[model samples]
Target chain A: MERPHNFSAGPCILPLEVFEKASQSVIDLDNSGLSILEISHRSTAFVGIIEKARELALQHLNLQDKGYKALFLQGGASMQFLMTAYNLLEKKAGYLDTGTWASNAIKEANNFGKTEVLASSKSSNYNYIPKDFLVPEGLDYLHYTSNNTIYGTQMKTFPKKENTPLVCDMSSDIFSRQLDYSQFDLIYAGAQKNMGPAGATLIVVKEDILGKVSRAIPSMMDYQLMIKKESMFNTPPVFSIYVSMLNLEWLSRNGGVPSIEKKNKAKADLIYSEIDRNPLFKGFTALEDRSMMNATFSLKDEQLGPKFDKLWKASHINGLNGHRSVGGYRASMYNALTLDSVKVLVDVMKNFEKTA
Target chain B: MERPHNFSAGPCILPLEVFEKASQSVIDLDNSGLSILEISHRSTAFVGIIEKARELALQHLNLQDKGYKALFLQGGASMQFLMTAYNLLEKKAGYLDTGTWASNAIKEANNFGKTEVLASSKSSNYNYIPKDFLVPEGLDYLHYTSNNTIYGTQMKTFPKKENTPLVCDMSSDIFSRQLDYSQFDLIYAGAQKNMGPAGATLIVVKEDILGKVSRAIPSMMDYQLMIKKESMFNTPPVFSIYVSMLNLEWLSRNGGVPSIEKKNKAKADLIYSEIDRNPLFKGFTALEDRSMMNATFSLKDEQLGPKFDKLWKASHINGLNGHRSVGGYRASMYNALTLDSVKVLVDVMKNFEKTA
Candidate 1:
């Protein structure tokens, strides 16, 4: 059966090969005569897989000797919101409230210590990224979301600061592009978007950035302890991490981050160009702050909504419906989506323009 | 290939039908044209699955009209070890330390409030349950492990209490037997044992048991908040819960807990009778306190260790090797293990005795 072109905001599309391998593993992993779902996480087979996942993550990011340790954890990025604060925040922290996820991080941090929203795009309903802002002095760290899934905005340029550390929620666009990963002191992403599934979170934390806080961090959330234990602090979401490893292997085999970035840009550009040129469509995010991952847009003529929805659905495009807050469509072009699929969506829009 | 009889303590065996259906869903779930791993948890398809899982849990437990709410949560039973304390341990709690897992629960609760060890079997290395214990009055709750996975002891009878609420960690044997569901206010289990996989936790909480604590519960750990949101407070472990729902469906069709309990007893009795008669092997837990889920035993003649190990491995048995702390073998028979599989292991043991 032919698979549909899926553009889900999260728990997003994955490589077909990875899915195929994972399906076989769910039946019997590596001829061990046990489903990957049933094997003990403490077993040598699974431990090897997890260790290799962390190693490959660091290797792909070129952060192998850069003092950053990669860990696979549970509870998604939501749990990381408070955990980042519990492990880092002492007196106060600065947050860039660019989107819902960033605001949620600030809200969770307030329970741990003083949190100041240094900049916010909320005033504009998160249509654009806030640029002109000063990084306050003496803050433990300045946190921000690398890409906003709902708002379709990406921080193309990171904030520069002295003395304070940088933390990022890179859930949507971690490996879609190349960057100097050493600049951030801490980074976390739910494995759903560009990685694998929804159960595990990928955390990359610098060693020296931990152990400064006075609070007793829960063992599950403690980055320092997770590093010490090699992310076996708890049972460690085995199936999610296993598939993540397979996805990472796919990424590495296909020229790693830079190659995927090229494909991602092509997909984004194709869809966004259609949104810009088509008379009936208009993008929701500002041009400069537009996401290379999620292309949020709406119909210029409201009456065409039903027809455009039908066209995309008929074209076998799944999850193109935008977030409710934005009231449009979001074509999430993650790392795995083919450029040909993007062309198919663009062609669908052209046909709709001719028909509607 | 013939499937091995997997006896893993946790992340253990699942029904073959559940595995097959789950494998297909990983490719295309219910012909929705989306991999179960990639679909948004907020989608109607997944929402229906989660709702059915909760409804089925209540129905199987005969607690549908008993004012109980079932939730599929993330972070496994380890997170619940902390959450149970965060939500319920306001001033002090009573804990019955039956084995490693119960002691771990007590240790985590200590960070929340004062805790009294009401009863413990530590003196005997947790080989038996401490029955001659009282559930002291004026306590926030009495927490105990329903099954000791490592020690192979199960609490066949729970302590009778009047005022204190009862909380249980039923990770090892949740659906393998039937019990008085209305007796406990809260019950949590890691789904890997009898349910499905490792990432999701099955929690059954009485609506009235929450909101008594004064401490600010983390949103992810707050039972009241989870109840209000129907466990969609965040993106859950989607794939894990979906398979768990399928496994629950399988359990319901295979005659729920009462019927499974009969088969579970038959399996346990067959293995224990062999351990008592074979002369080469001896049971670990005392006869009266032995578990119907995990039957732990050791070789009477340690010199025949390699010979016995090879014999079982040749017979296509998996995960019979015990934990390092206990230098023996533990055969964990969950709801999915069949009577014929138990016979295969019993036959292997008899063959080993005759040869040795």
Candidate 2:
């Protein structure tokens, strides 16, 4: 049976080759007569795997040898909401309120210190990105969500300010595009999105931004300690990191971020064009601030919902429904989502228009 | 090639059948046409998987319908060290420091509130369980390590005190032996040892013991919030939880904890008898407190290390080397480790004695 076109927002699709290689390793890693699950995190073999993953993550982001350390930590990006504050929020931090996750990051940071909302798109129901926001001086760091998965909005340009560090929760769109990677001092992404599976979170941080917080940080929440220990603070999510390493290797072999960016653009163009041309459908989010990773849209005729749902289901489309906050449909096109899958959805949309 | 006996401390061995099932599921889950890795946490399929894992965990511990909630959380047991204190430590807590991890637990708890050491075996290099520790009145909770992987010490009996909530970090020994699990108000274990893989941590908490502390806990660290959210406060480590559910199913099918305990005792007995009978070997921990899961022993003749190592390697033994704190051999016999593996190690030891 053919695999369906997976469009789940975050924890979405990964390359089929990664699943195959990871599945094989689960039984026997390199014919070592031991399952990858059984291998010790302290073993030289696992050490090489994690180190290679860290290297590849930086390489894909074009940030190698640029004073940044990549760590494969647990607890997902949600944990980073607190950990980023624990490690960096001493006096005050600035956050751009973009969507549900961005608001969550702000809430977690407020527990540590004063969090200033530098800008917000909440008034528009996060339909657009807040642009040309005034920069506040003396802030510890300016944080923002690079892409809002639920609202289907992405930051086309980032907040640039000297003397204030830039932090980003790029959980939904981290290796999907090429940008000025070094502009952000810290960037965290949950592995469920473009990386690999759910357990491990990739955190890339500049060495100098740490050791500035005054509060007593728990060892597990301390980034400096994790960096010093080479991300083996305590038995890392071994299988998650290993599979992530495999995915990173896949990303590298497929021409890194630049090549994938072009493909992502093509997938986005095909779907968004269909949404615009179809009379029965309308796109969610502002046209100028639309997300390339997740495109949210709705049927113009509410009564036609059942027909459209049946069509997508018959076409073997998975996770096409939008989030509860925005009731409609969402088509997530991650790096591993082939352009052919998007074409299938577009074909379904075109057929639905004639029948309706 | 024959599979080696894996005795690595944690992130250790699991059942072979679990590995096979998990490997197959990574490619296709229950004929769903979706790779398990790609499924959303909120999907009905994944919700069933996580709910089953939680139910199985409770059923194995005999804590079903007993006001205890089993949560498959992330960040390992290290995160629990702080989270336990964050949620339960109101004024002061008592701790029994048995090994490296217990001490770390105490250190993290101290950051929250006053922590009193009831007793410690650290003076003797943690070679014994500190017994008959005096329990003080008015303490919020009493915490101890159920099994010390590095020292090979197990608490054969727990400290019982009226009205004091008992918290145990059962990372290495959970489900390996049957105990009165209801006695402890809270228990947390990293899934790598005797559970499944190295990503998910199983946290079983008696609902009444929480919400007593005055300190505000971070959302990710807050147990009450996680319980309310059904462990889906954010994207959980889905693959790890699925594999854990598979392992728990394997455990349930194999007669749950009671039957595994008997097999564990048999393996422990086979190895401990050899350690005593062989002139070159001596046990690390006290005889009364020797852990059934891990047997730490060293050669009396330092020069025989090379010969013993070579014999074990030849006999397909893996992770036999002890931690650096105690430079010797540690044969970790987790739940999934077979008795045949124990016999292989014993045979290697007997051959080493004869050759030397």
Candidate 3:
């Protein structure tokens, strides 16, 4: 059977070639005659894998010469919520609570220091990005989420803050588009999204910005220690990191982030155009603030839900259903999502209208 | 090529059946047509995997009606080192410093509370388990490493501590043998040895002993919260957990721990008997404290090492090289290591002696 177009919010679609490579490695990695899952992390074969992975991440993100280090660590983005605070939040930090992930980041930051919310979109249930926000002076750092996974919103442009470090949670949109990757002092993304599997987190940190905190950070949560150890601080998520490396290799081979971004734009435009033209469907997010990765929409006639659902299912659409908080539809088109798949979804929407 | 006799200390051998299943899942799980890596962790299919993993862990350990909960967590046992202290260490804790792992656990515990080294085998370079130790009545808990991976020593008998909770880091040798597992109040193992991959940790805790500390525990590190959420507190190490579940299933099908223990004993005895008989090599650990999981040894004639190394390599004995500190050899015979492999190793030693 052909694999369906999976639009899961995360741990979502990955390149088919990457999956095949990962599957092969799980059986016998580098012909060492041991499952990648069974080999020691410190073995020469695995150490080369991790080194290559870190090198690939730095190279792909264009952070190799930018005084930044790419670390493939464990615990995902949620662990980073606390780790970022434990490392950087000394006196105070400013946060823009654009969505659920940003608010959660703010909550965790409050545990370490005075985290002032400079802007919040909760007033409108995060339907749009919070602009007209202050990037205050005297802050240790200004933090924000680049893309809101749950709310289907994104920051089109970043705010300019003078002399203040910027931190971004790019968990949902790390490699889906082209961006100036060197601007932020810190950036983190869970690998499950565009990177790889669910266990490892890809953290890009500027080397000079650490060790400013007075508190003794736990070894596991300390960024300085991880960077010092070159991300082998402990037994890393080996399988996760290996799979991520395979995905990174795949991305590099198929033209880097810029090429993928073009394909992503074409896919997103197809779905958004269908949502706008289709009489039976309406997008939930404001036009300017809509996410290219996740396009949230709802039916114009709520009673036709069963018909639309049947149509999409018959068309082999998986995870087209939206998040429970905004119950309608979410077509998440990450890097791995094909334009042809988007056409299928658009065709489903148009065919459903004719039937109605 | 067939998988070699992988004698890696941790991230060691697994059943061939587990590896095949894990490889298939990496491609497509349960015929979902989507790679397990590409599916949402929140999907019912994934949730069922975690549930079955927890259930199997409890069932295999005979803890079903024992008021204990099994958790498949991320960050490995290194994270548990600090978390164990955060949740349980209130004022004081007792530690048995058996080896590197035990000492590290004590070091982490000391950050949260006063930790007393109740016993230590470091005087002998941790080549033997300490027999004389007192579990004080006023301690919060007694922590120890069940198997010392580096030093190749294991505790055959545990001290009976009345009114004192027992915490065991069974990281390197959790399911390789049969033991009264319910004796431990908190048992944590990094699931690289005798289980599955490196990303997940197996933690079994007696439910009634949590929430005794005053500190606000970090969400990721809080055992009570993890128990409440059933270890889905965050995006878990899904690939690792699924592989661990498959390994556990294989263990259940292959006569469980008791049957595995019989085979493990046979393997260990085969290698040890050869070490005792062979004049070219000598075992490292004391006879009484010799580990069934890891058999550490060194060449009797150090100058004959090169020839012996060549012999083992020819015999397809992988990871027989001991830790750098030990500077010799380590034949780690975990559950998946067949007695036939041990016979092969023993045959290699005999052949090497004849050549010498």
Candidate 4:
């Protein structure tokens, strides 16, 4: 049976091949006569699996041997919002509030110390990425969200500054496109999008930026300790990391980030072009700032939502509904989603347009 | 192919039927044409899965509709060490230091407020559970580990006290035994053992116990907010929770905790009986306090170690090596490990003794 067009904005789509291998491994891992779920996290096989995942994550981002370490942590990026501040925020930190997640990161940071919102797009409902932000000196770190999944906006250019450390919540758009990954001191992404599954959060941090905070960081939240323990700080999400390893292997075999980036661009272009050309719908975010991962759009006539919804449902589409915060349609095009799936969605949009 | 007798401590054995269903769901969930890994946590299907899992968890613990809320949070029990303190540690908290995890919990709680060690078994290398410890008045809560995985000791009786809240880390032997689970104000367990896999942590808390602490709790760590969000505080460990839901369904179908407890007792009895009867083997922990889940034992003659190892390996035993802290063999018979597996291990031990 053909797979449905999965556009759910994370806990989202991963490679189908990864799923097949994971399915087999759940019953019997590498023919070891034991299920992956039953294996100890400290087992040699699991250590190798997690190590390879860490390696592949850095390799995809072109951050190998760059004074950086990758960790597969739990609690999603939401936990990282607290941890980044827990380990870094001593006196104060700077935040670029692009969307809901960034605002949340700032909220968690307030529990530790001062959180300076250097720039925010909340006034405009986070419809576009805030730019031309002035950076101040003596800040512990400058934080930003690389991609705003809820608002359908992504940072095209990162803040370039010296002395201050750069931190990013790349939950929605890491490994989707090639970038100067080493430029950021710390980067964290929830594995649900463009990686594998939901449980694991991929944190790639420059080692030098740690140990500067005065506060005592909990073992689970301490990145330096997690690195020292090799992401096995305490029972690192076994199955999540294993499947993530499989997905990263898939990404590596499919020409890594550069190759997948081209495909992602194509998918984004196809859907966005249709939304622009088709008068019945309008894109949500600014054209220049629209995310390549999640393309949020709205029907021109609110009364025609039922008609468009029916068209998409008939075409075997899934997760087309936008977040309630942003009332419209969101077509999340993660790496695993094929371009043919996007075409099916565009066709549904065209059919809806012609019919309504 | 015959499956190995898996004796992994935690992230240990789960029902094979759960594995089969999880395997199929990974490819396609209930004919939904979508991989379980790809479904959004907010999706209707996933919401149902989480809700059912939560209900089952409470039902198995016999804590349903008794002012208890079950949350499938991420970061394992390690995160809960900090969270329990972050949310509840006020003025002073008492801890019963049974083993490594208990020590770690006390350490994390120290960062928050005054943590009084009520009693400890560290003097004897945690070989026995400390008994008849006096419960202090005005304590915020009394904390203890229900089962010590590394040391192979289980709490047969809990502190009988009123007024002071009771919190227990039931990570290893949660569903393996029937208990007055409502007596404890809060209970947390890592899903790796007796539930599902590593990643999701089950937290069962009474509603009235929250919002008592003065310190500001982070969103991810705050149980009240998590309960309010119905465990969807953030994108949860989706696949882990789904597998846990499946495992819980399996447990429910197999007659829940009472029925599993009898089987667990049988497995523990079989292994312990063999250890006592076989002259070459001696049990590790105190006989009275021996764990039902993990039966740690060592060879009487050191020279026969290789011979015993060879016998178990030949019999297809896996994860029999004990924890580094306790240098012996540990046979962890979780809820999924059949009595036949225990018999196989016992036979291997009998054969080893006869050969020696």
Candidate 5:
């Protein structure tokens, strides 16, 4: 198979070094004679792995004492959505709908209690993040997706009301850029995106916001149990945890989020410039709310569809197709995506524009 | 540092090749330019992986339309102990306490409904599997552990009863030998010992025994939800599932269990013979009920204990320490243990006997 830039939504691309080192651990971890998979989670070595992963996460996010406890949990961000509601919401909840994931959060939260859709841009086919969205006054909590990957809409700026705690699903944008996490009571992202791997979900929850729920949560859903155990309530995905550590280490060494944010700006700029300059191509999402992580667009000449798709595939480019939930093509420029790859896509788009 | 024979009860030894292959997937799954750790559970490739893993499990266990569904879950056997009760036992339950794990099953079962210790060998320190154990007339199910890795005891025979289900935690010795599995209503195992890794738990439950409970179980804890989703209700541990496939493949090529049973017997016979015949060492477990997996023993000369431990460590043998609850050395010869390793232990015992 030709080397293609993977734009598949998670479990997405990981650094080559993370894979190679993680592979070797399957045979023998740090030459300990036991496969990393064979070691006990209760063992000191794994305990260190979990702790280091947590420490790196804190350092990388620079939220060491922002009233948040970082937790690496099983299940995925979907589970965290339920857990967030299970732990926090008693009567009713508030959700800002920008895309599929935020709506998914709303659906799961509704299973537990009343979930009010505070605002939605669904009437615009989710092309924009509704700026005038109202987060209800008496909501148990307000939730939003930081970056909408499917529809390619992102909220460039957040409205801050210090009285209410914010919960954000930064699944697609985590580690891609720094955030004012202090404004959020809870943040969760599945690791497949910019973090490490798919099997673990990273949750940053403010401890003070807990202990208000009246329901008896089963042990698996209880954030308190996860916190008490320090996310070692059971055997965590060790390999995922370790690879995440490697990615975190990579992020920290490369001047952290500030440096990566610049690289992100450059890549997003190149691809968006291509989309704007081209006559045949048009970005589908509302321009002001365009995503930096995922750039989505389509051809104005619908008949050129087959030729354009075939061109990108022939050039060994992958994950360039948009989500089937909405039509057209999308390019996910995650953290692992390099500037050259974006240039390749830009060049491909330019040629397609000229030919059309 | 030293190559010690691992005696860790769960999160125990696994097939070396499984570890190697599993590790490779962690970094790069099927060379898809995607790490298995980062792959989507919904992707065609990962769906195949989960499906095939479940198929192999069903095929190997000869589950045979017994109305049993096989699922890969988390929280280990301990969670299953509670889940089994939550799903099936609306009334009273019965548990036979042979050792630590079986008692744990009883403990978790009590959290849901009434539980009777139908039989217990705790009085004898659980050295022997009690025979002619009474199966209570009216109970939800009779629970037993097939093998006691901690106490070095094996239940050679199970209670023969119809109309009632037999639930067993075959965690330590699930694939060690053949069994009339038709007799068991539900069987669950943590995969670290005879199966694969720690993060995943395998459960086989008959359909008839479920849907009886009144208490609301968290969706994560409900076995039925796992079965319904084919164990992908949430992000299943992809790396662990892949490793389990390798182990299952290894087991299949190994002429399945018929071949493994013979090898397990031979290894146990060689080591048990040395312990029974040797004068300086006495088998700590009852002779009639010694474990084929965990062989426990102590020296007649207690002062030479430090020397024996150091000697084994110097010889590059490891994981020989027994449980802190039961102090002594235990040689756990799971499926991956070569007969040659047991010979090494037998030879060491012989040399110590002559010197004493």
Candidate 6:
């Protein structure tokens, strides 16, 4: 089977080698005479896979001694939006609303504790991340979604901490860039975007900050409970975690985040530069805060949008449609996305310009 | 890759056709040139798959106009344990504690509201399902685990559920028996046991019985919110749902649950008869209440248990070890396990008996 450049946003393209390794195990896993699905989460074969995956995820994030523990959990990242609040929000929490997912996270966090939206760029249709957010001193934590996947804006820097903990929902752009552990006390992302599959969520949490919440959390939802059980609180999504490990292995082989971040910037630069140069299209996000992972752009002529979509789909290009919450084309170039895929988009843009 | 008789308690076996069909789609899904993972959850490819899987599941259970909505959500049946209590436990809920999972359910449910143990079989080592448990009047709902997977006991007939809505965590024994779903208002199962994989959980709930709870429920944990969104409230486990759909199709082709129930009984009878007749071993659960899905037994000469396990594993018989919480062997016969596999186990028992 010939592989095309897959760019569907999360549950997105895993590496081709990952597909080969994962598919082989489906038929016969680890010489256990059981398909990987049938292998027990408690079995020795699966334990090794899970342990390796957890270690690799932590190392990839450079989270060693970062006052945080990594957890592979089910229910994707939307779940962590709630779990994070449930576990952390004993007192008031502050949020910076940048885009759709960030607003959703704030709404979910509101259900648990008082939420203060320190700033919002919604009035500008979220073109730029809010830079002047009022962070009240002594709040429980200052929470923000680091990257707006839908809006294609990112917080290039963390808010100054007045001793309040920082929590980030870094679902779309976690490993595609470099980060300092000193800035944030907690971070979580679904493995689908930059990591691997859809089932597992990678949570890095400061251990001491947990268990301070006063509400009666369901045991499965408790971060401290999950940490004590070593992410085996229930049968973890075994195969997804294994696939994520393979993805991380690929990342490590290609030189870690610094190397990948440079590649990611190059890909985003090529596509965004095309949108800027061509008279037919215009970039959507605030230019100062445009993302390296998701590039949201729109045609200057509205009628050409559908035509462009059809053209891309015909070429077997995928997941370039902007989120339904926003209307345009969003070319999400996560870690697995190649510079060559970006070249195809650039070519399409140049051809579209010649015709328009 | 020779297949073994996989008796994994959960994260269990699936039909070969289901795996083959699913694998083909993994790379090039539904003619979309996208891995099923990369395809949009809202795409016609996935919505149809999710809806079809729900319909097939309801069909297999013979449920009709129960006004029940089927949802495929994450967090497994364990999440349902709490969600059931949150939705229906406005005043109080009743639970029947049977095994490890049952007790876990009760513990989670207690967090929502007041819970009473209507009955328990722990005194009998969970070997006999309670025949005469009392159903207290005026309860919001009656919660029970249909099959105790670890202890290998099943309810032959539920205690008469009248007026009270019957909510069951049917995680272990669903699809293995012919059931009158009218006896219960709600039924849910983690798909790992009899259905397909670990990532997706199936919940069947009556629409009219919801919204009675007084507590503020988180959106992900709220059944009504998920049903309203048709389980598209968040990005769901697309690959897991697709595989479950393929498994459902296979089950329908194999003549639905009625046909499968006959085979399940035959398989259970073969293994149990050997355990009863052979001097080397004895069945753990009572004859009337033993589960068709999980058959637990141990050597009469306790010293030979380790030797028995070694013999089975050496012959490539896998996942036969009992849960650590319950120290004995448990052979799980999910829908994917054929009668031939059961025959092989029966022959092994006979050979071991003669040699002993």
TM-score list, all predictions: 0.98, 0.99, 0.98, 0.99, 0.89, 0.97
lDDT of 6 by residue, A219-336 (tens): 8888888998988888777767877787888889889898999999999899989989999888998899999988998888899887787777766677787887678889889888
Give the TM-score (vs. native) of candidate 2: 0.99
lDDT against the true structure, each candidate: 0.90, 0.93, 0.88, 0.92, 0.80, 0.82
TM-score, model 5, chain B versus true chain B? 0.95
User: How large a fraction of the reference contact set does each model reproduce?
Assistant: 0.63, 0.88, 0.74, 0.92, 0.47, 0.49
DockQ for all models, in order? 0.73, 0.87, 0.77, 0.89, 0.43, 0.62
Model 5: colliding residue pairs: A11-B38, B4-B317, B4-B318, B5-B318
CAPRI class of candidate 4 = high
Instruction: Identify the CAPRI category of the predicted complex in candidate 6.
Output: medium
- What is the per-residue lDDT of model 1 for residues A1-356, given as tens digits with 9 covering 90 to 100? 77888888888899989988999999999998899998999999999999989988888888998889999988889889978998999999999999988988888888889999988989788999999999878999999899999999999988868878999999999989989888898999999998899999999988888899988876666788888989876677899999999999999999999899888888888999999999999999889999999999999988889988999899899899989888889999999889988998999999999999
CAPRI tier for the interface of model 5: acceptable
Off by over 4 Å in 4: none
Off by over 4 Å in 3: none
Q: How accurately is candidate 6 docked according to DockQ? A: 0.62
Better of 1 and 3 by DockQ: 3
Candidate 4 structure lDDT: 0.92
Q: In model 1, what lDDT does residue B116 have?
A: 96
lDDT string, candidate 6, B261-324, tens digits: 9999999988898889988988888888889998999887888877777678766677888777
- For B1-356, candidate 1 gives per-residue lDDT tens digits of 99998888888899988999999999899987779998998999999999999998888878888889999888878789899998999889999999888888888888789899998889888898888887777899999899989889998888858878999999898888889878989999988898878889999999887898887777777888889999988789999999999998998898899999999999999999999999899998889999999999999888889999999999999899887767699999999989999999999998888889
Q: Whose lDDT is greatest here?
A: 2
| lDDT score for residue B150 of model 6 | 91
lDDT of 3 by residue, A95-197 (tens): 9988877887887777778999998879888899888887878898889899988878988888868878889999999987878888888999999888999
**Cα displacement (Å) at residue B294, model 5:** 2.7
